[model samples]
Every structure is written in structure tokens, then in C-alpha cells.
Target chain A: DQQVKQNSPSLSVQEGRISILNCDYTNSMFDYFLWYKKYPAEGPTFLISISSIKDKNEDGRFTVFLNKSAKHLSLHIVPSQPGDSAVYFCAASTPGYALNFGKGTSLLVTP
Target chain B: DTAVSQTPKYLVTQMGNDKSIKCEQNLGHDTMYWYKQDSKKFLKIMFSYNNKELIINETVPNRFSPKSPDKAHLNLHINSLELGDSAVYFCASSQDPSGRVGDTQYFGPGTRLTVL
Candidate 1:
């Protein structure tokens, strides 16, 4: 069963615009959420994360918003650059547990 | 410097063959994990080890086994590899001795396994 889901398989955005990717989960026990960015032929790398206690967390141009009541979270990239084009994965887990990852969404930032 | 490294970036073999993928991390982390990205692009955790001790084992087949000789290395050995076992395998590490779930994990460039 897929506990984490990223319904959108792909998204396209213009450079310098906003790019938003959404994810949902069925497991309520997951208290930690993370976003990972991946490129072709490379492994996924950590991007940003948010805890259940906080509703939002931001780092540079990347911001993650979590809504526990809805079991939904989102990653927003402001002023999206061409270099930001990559596949993004959403993962969730509780303390001491292995992470559950989504299928991932591919983002294309066009100049 | 590479924080995590995997040997044999690509492996192509016939079904029923046995194969092994070696992984190493120089980050001085306490925990290591193995994840498989299947054809559907789902990155699923297969196993985890902490300080050379097994901590988690998902519903992976018995043909797959993870061996951690030290805190810095985790290797996967597959016996009687099947066609469905073909996928990109990733090795990851984190410094979470306390088992914090959100600790950032560093991943190695994946090893793509092909079973014909």
C-alpha cells in the first residue's frame, strides 16, 4: 500500500515564478515529513522538512507547509530557477521508523 | 568528497544469477539504510542498520540480504535474482543514534540493477 501519494506526476513552471508541489498521506502516525530532490542518474537528496508541531518551514527559496489535520503537505519554490528542475519526492515517518516515500513528481522550470 | 559511495553503478545480469552491491559512507554516521526504487518510481526502504546491528527489515524477499560489517558500510547481496528484482538501489546514512525520524539522510548515486 502506498502510504504517501503525490497525485501529480509532473509540473511545469516558468523561471522566476512560483512552483508548488503537493503530497498527501494516509498514515496519521507520521509526524515527520521531508522533501527530497533527485536528478537523472543520481540519488534523491534531502531538501526541506517539517515536523508535526510546526505548520511551515522555509529555507532560502524552498518552503514546506504541513497540514496535519488534512494529512497533506506541500513544497513551494519561489522564483523557480532552471536548475530547480528535477524530480521531488515526499517522505514521511515517525520516530525510529523507516520512511515511506511517494512516487515523486517531476518539475520542469523553463526559461 | 563523496559522503556516500556505492560500487558498480550499473549491473546487468541474467535471471537466477547472484549479485552483490557494496556501499560505504565516510560521514561517520551511526545509521545506514538501503532503498530500492522500482519501475513505478517508488523509493521503498528495504533495510536499516544502526551501529552494525539490524534495526528494520521491510517485506523484502529472502533472496535479498543486507550485511553491515562496520558502522560505515552496508552491502546488499541477492541470491537467485529474479526479473522483478531489477531496480535502482540506493544507500543512505544519517547520524541519528537517538533514532530521530527526521534526521537528514545522505544518499549515494544509485546502482542500477538489470535482470534479464
Candidate 2:
């Protein structure tokens, strides 16, 4: 079964605007959540991560918010750049376990 | 320099043919993993090796085998290929598999495997 889910298959946003991508999970054991960005023909690169202990974590324009009670998480990109256009994957993992990934959401940033 | 690298970025083979995909990491990490992204684009873990020891083996077919020759290299071999095996395979490495707060995994460019 798919424990992690990204309901949105694609998103389009204007440059310099805020981009929000959401994710949900059914497993409560997952304590770590991560977001990865992949360009065409390239591997997914780690964008940001948040532990269940905290509700939010930020790095530059990327921020990840986690709500353990709701079993949901969202990635926010401020002033989204055209270079940020790619497929973003939401992943979750528990201690000593491999990551469970979502199907991914393709985000397109337009000028 | 690439932290994680996989050989033969693209592989096309016929059914029943055997093939191998090699992975190497220069990040000095002890944990390596193989992940397959199917047509649905769901990235699933196939196998994991920690210090050259098998730790996590998912419900993959027996035809798929993972071998770790050392801490820096992990190779995947398929005995019999099938059309269903067509997917993008990725190799990743982390400091450890304990899933610590800061234990981030780095991924390779990935290999596109196509079976006819």
C-alpha cells in the first residue's frame, strides 16, 4: 500500500510568488519527512526536511511544515524561481527504515 | 566531484537478458541503497546495505540481487530481465541507516533501464 501520498500531480506558479506543495501519510511511525526536487534526466536532490519533533523547518527559500496530528506536511517555497521548476517528491521514514515516497508533484515556475 | 555515481546512465536490453548496474559513492558513507521508480513514478526501495551487509530487502523479485563489494560500492544484478523491469533505478547513500535527525541521503543521477 502507498503510505505516503501527494495528491497534486502538478502545480504552476508565477516567479517570485509563493509555491505550496502538500503531502500526507497514513503511518504514524514515520518521524522524519523530507522533500526532494528532480529535474529532467537528473536525480532527485534533497531540498529540505523536518522531523516530527518540530512543526517547521526552513532553509533559504524552502521550508517544510509538518503536522503530526493531522498526518500531513507541506513544502513552501518563497519567491519561487524559474529554476525551481521540477518534480518534487515527499518522503517519510521511521527509525531504521527506508524511506516511503509519494508519487511526486511536478511544479512549474513561469516567468 | 560527484558524491554518488551510477554507471551506464541508460541501459536497453531484450527480455531474458541479464544485466548489471553499478553504483559507487565517494562520500565515505557506510549505508547504500537501491531504489526503483516505476512508470507511476513511485520511488520504492529495493535493497539496502550497511557496511557491506544486507539489512533491508523489500518484496522484490528473486531475479534482482544486490551486492556490495565494499563500503563505497554497491552493485545490482538481474538474472532474467522482463518488460516489467523497465524503470529508472537510483542509488543513494547516507552516513547511516539509523534515521537520525541529520542523517541525509544523497542520490545518484539514476540509470534508465529499458527491457524489451
What docking tier does model 2 reach?
Answer: medium
Docking class of 1: medium
Top candidate when judged by DockQ against the true structure? 2
Over A14-109, each residue of candidate 2 has an lDDT whose tens digit, in order, gives 999999999999999999999989999988888888889999999999999999999999999999999999999999998899989999999999
Error of 1 at B105 (Å): 0.7
Deviation of model 2 at A19, angstroms:
0.3
Over the stretch B1-116, how does candidate 2's per-residue lDDT look in tens digits? Answer: 99999998999999999999999999999899999999999999999999999999999999999999999999999988999999999999998684455668889999999999
What Cα-based lDDT does every candidate model obtain? 0.93, 0.94
Q: Distance (Å) between predicted and true CA of A6, model 2? A: 0.3
- Candidate 2 chain A lowest-lDDT run of ten: A42-51
Taking chain A of model 1 alone, its TM-score versus the true chain A equals 0.99
Name the runs in model 1 displaced over 4 angstroms.
B97-102
Model 2 RMSD, rounded to 1 decimal:
0.9
> Per-residue lDDT of A1-111 in model 1, one digit per residue for the tens?
999999999999999999999999999999889999999999899998888999999999999999999999999999899999999999998877888899999999999
